[model samples]
Target chain A: MTGSAVSATALIWVDGERASALPLPDRGLDFGDGLFETLLLRAGVPQFQHLHLDRLAAGLQRLAFPDCLDRVRNCLQQAAGELQDYPWSALRLTVTRGSAPRGYAAPADARPRVVITAAPLHQDRCQPGAPVALDWAQLHWSSQPLLAGIKHLNRLEQVLVANQLADLPADELVVLDAQGHVCSVSAGNLFMLERGQLLTPALETCGIAGTRRRLVLEQLAPAISIPVAETHISPAQLTAADEVFVCNSIRGLQPVTSLGPRQWHDHSVCRALHEEYVGAMSC
Target chain B: MTGSAVSATALIWVDGERASALPLPDRGLDFGDGLFETLLLRAGVPQFQHLHLDRLAAGLQRLAFPDCLDRVRNCLQQAAGELQDYPWSALRLTVTRGSAPRGYAAPADARPRVVITAAPLHQDRCQPGAPVALDWAQLHWSSQPLLAGIKHLNRLEQVLVANQLADLPADELVVLDAQGHVCSVSAGNLFMLERGQLLTPALETCGIAGTRRRLVLEQLAPAISIPVAETHISPAQLTAADEVFVCNSIRGLQPVTSLGPRQWHDHSVCRALHEEYVGAMSC
Candidate 1:
């Protein structure tokens, strides 16, 4: 599903204070010099909270950001507590290298800023196992191992993909790396069921290592007694798979019903994975 | 030179009004969904104003941004008229796809926002033709043809380069593309002089097309009877070159005095180009 419009009912906090504006000099706005995490909030509780924070922490370390994990965690926790009224909502946490002089070199005593926004998601859009049509995006992700899987804010690539998606007939687009290897969906992780084994693309050189993707690979698949592997999957292999699905924190798992002319009617593997993952998320 | 501190004397404006805060949901902060131009303000006049605006306009078209060039031009002219007191300054003009819903897709009717900030520069730092030592950056630029040469806001790669520069003894770092082809210095375009010919890495795969670089390539070099070519350059070729220099709007040109152990004592070509380019910019 496309991103829901952030309604007036949305809650926003900048550095733990109730605010709706950021300094113009913020590195986040200046250079996209930051990291962000979007997690699902259920009944005021953030789903996969630790996983999101862990990813943010990893990204901070990768970007050589100052230690601001504790502050970010506090901000998320505080915002989630206030977002309990909405049964299903999306909580986006943004951590920037604060405001520095006009330069790429971050100040030695940089003070990081955290922005937390919680927006309500329609209940119907939050349901899992909905089948979606996919189109291959003409734009390919560039390989930068240093920034891969970090979910940092250099997302113009995805923005351009969204620009392409506006004119496409499909519900989502599958993006590949510069080498034309399958990478991910426009906004989620991709999985394929082949010969009773589930396969996902290894995000070594590109794509975000999504939190829900981790839940399925590390826990759900093992619990369901399905063999899973993270490997390179070519477009031909993807189209030839028995079942295909996309997953993210907000939209747990969506079965892919069609890709160009190829269609998969049987989504047994995707449904099973979604049910198990949802069951795990509630715990 | 490293970016100067945006001092208290700096002037700021947002959307044609004096302000220092941006809406929280601005796409620039969210997805870096925007383009920026950093121009040199000499004696209240922006050097290469049209060149910077032309590049920004091209980038806006590439990014599918809403048509806002006229507004941007108006903002720049208004700001330049107010900065007559600062003999030397840097004017950064940023155009973002305004505030939008939390998503990658740009709204059909995006209201673009412009942020203009003028920061005074130390007269000493504004001088051209200073020689700088260069070190090889361990981090390489990922090749994304779609985003190449556009000075968009997604600059985490350059931030990472600056991180590498902090601990290095060199004044600047020479970055390579993913394929190990010489791309640019940390914050400017790279040029190598060899056998009386000027060679610069083609920005088709990566690197920014700086306005000053354009001046040197299209005007200054030709004016001084030097042949220039935009082609792939290897690290070996760069080191073996007779002379090396880097250029950007803020810093007209800088001669490369040393790269590792290799040192260049003769900077006749670089000096000549710098003088001609400066003369052109002033006129």
Candidate 2:
């Protein structure tokens, strides 16, 4: 499960039409002027889909992209409907500012594009209790308030961090912000249990506001009666925490077994929240 | 000249082959894990070709891209040779970590893809003496030392700034860093002359190191007996400067006539540097 692979029998669609290629001039390819969402498909139905769409809408508005949420929603629904054969699948929906002649100034009459790809997920990779190890990444995320909390395509920082993780002995890397505050993991949101309270990084200046993170903060943790706080967590505090875990849309919840020299065998809080999340996703 | 257009007769190539589309799974679109070089093609020759290629090579190395510099050079040469019919053309060369499975970790056997597009430039838009007006942009750049000088594809900041400029009265906008230090304009390197000395923002923290900027700093300024320095600049320093200008590979040099309420009527330093740059390009 550490290195999940996309199956060869993947399906693709561009603007609701089946296609294997994207236009050469799409701004998504040109400037990374786009947003993307990675969702989990359970029994042919997209889990927490409305939340994903809402996040995409907010990101598009922040990027000043023309209104194309309806088209994107339709594309996602159509793609999901076609993936009914696969019980568990992963969907990646990307919305770009579409093709333009050249230059940064988006054309007044610009049309947005939607690219959706669906691939079957291996059953073994969906285990929520799989413990993982993390190493501190040397690469730090830059703070950009305007782009923070939005899932945009300008992910070179994460790419670099992922590359770093490949050379280390960890399944994931603990990434810090430019100011030396622990922000998140390479691909997901992080939460640490300290003194019976749940705390995650506040994403006002950087990091993505993941849908699963929202689910945990708004629904799962609250249902379990855990006090949650979105605040800054220092490296020392994280290392000294009672328990730690990371979560994302596809991987509901994963307990952090080891981070550097620190190790934790107990995951009671992570288990409770993950159980609540699984129950919520089922409905 | 402010909004130069790419002519309808544009030619494109992918991976050294003539094509108008890219494979859907390319990482350049997925993660913006790529580098780009925009060059001015004159008489079938790419102006400042060595400089541009050098910058691209440095960027690719920084991004840990596969060794594809030789391949990129061949593709660029082939594209330029076919554009001999057009006297003045603009060539955009983009190199992306080619297609791969759905993951942030780059594959060891990754193949790089190069996409080059050439379009004839309007003769009128090449005027280097065109004085442009500017306004301070509300958007600020994030400081990422690892990616500061590389011309990578994560350009959403510039896209947003371009959108802001479209709504404003200025032709360009002054963009600062998170620390409120002057960085550059929306699309080019900025330089200012204050008290008979030349000053430009250092690229160690942010901003792309433009090839034309190198020409101005290394050769043109030295030849004309103008002292130059690359250091951090502030908004007050910019507004109080004797003159200001911007430069990129496509646009040789452009003087700023006014910024907000501040005005610059004397273009002696800018004119001298532009003349020297033109002479160098002609050779």
Angstrom error at residue B74, model 1: 0.9
Error of 1 at B102 (Å): 1.8
Instruction: Tell me the TM-score of chain B in each candidate.
Output: 0.95, 0.95
lDDT of each: 0.87, 0.88
TM-score to true structure, per model: 0.96, 0.96
User: Candidate 1, which segments miss by more than 4 Å at Cα?
Assistant: A1-10, A124-126, B1-10, B124-126
Tens digit per residue, CA lDDT, model 1, A190-246: 999999999999999999999988988998899889999999999999999999999
Kindly list the interface RMSD, in angstroms, of each predicted candidate in the order they appear: 0.8, 0.7
Model 2 residue runs over 4 Å out of place are A1-10, A124-126, B1-10, B124-126
* lDDT at position B60, candidate 2: 89
Predicted structure 2: lDDT:
0.88
B-chain TM-score of model 1: 0.95
Writing each residue's lDDT as its tens digit, candidate 2 over B1-118 gives 1134333454889988888788878899999989999999886688989999999989989999889999999999998878766678889999999988888999899999999887
In model 2, the number of clashes is 0
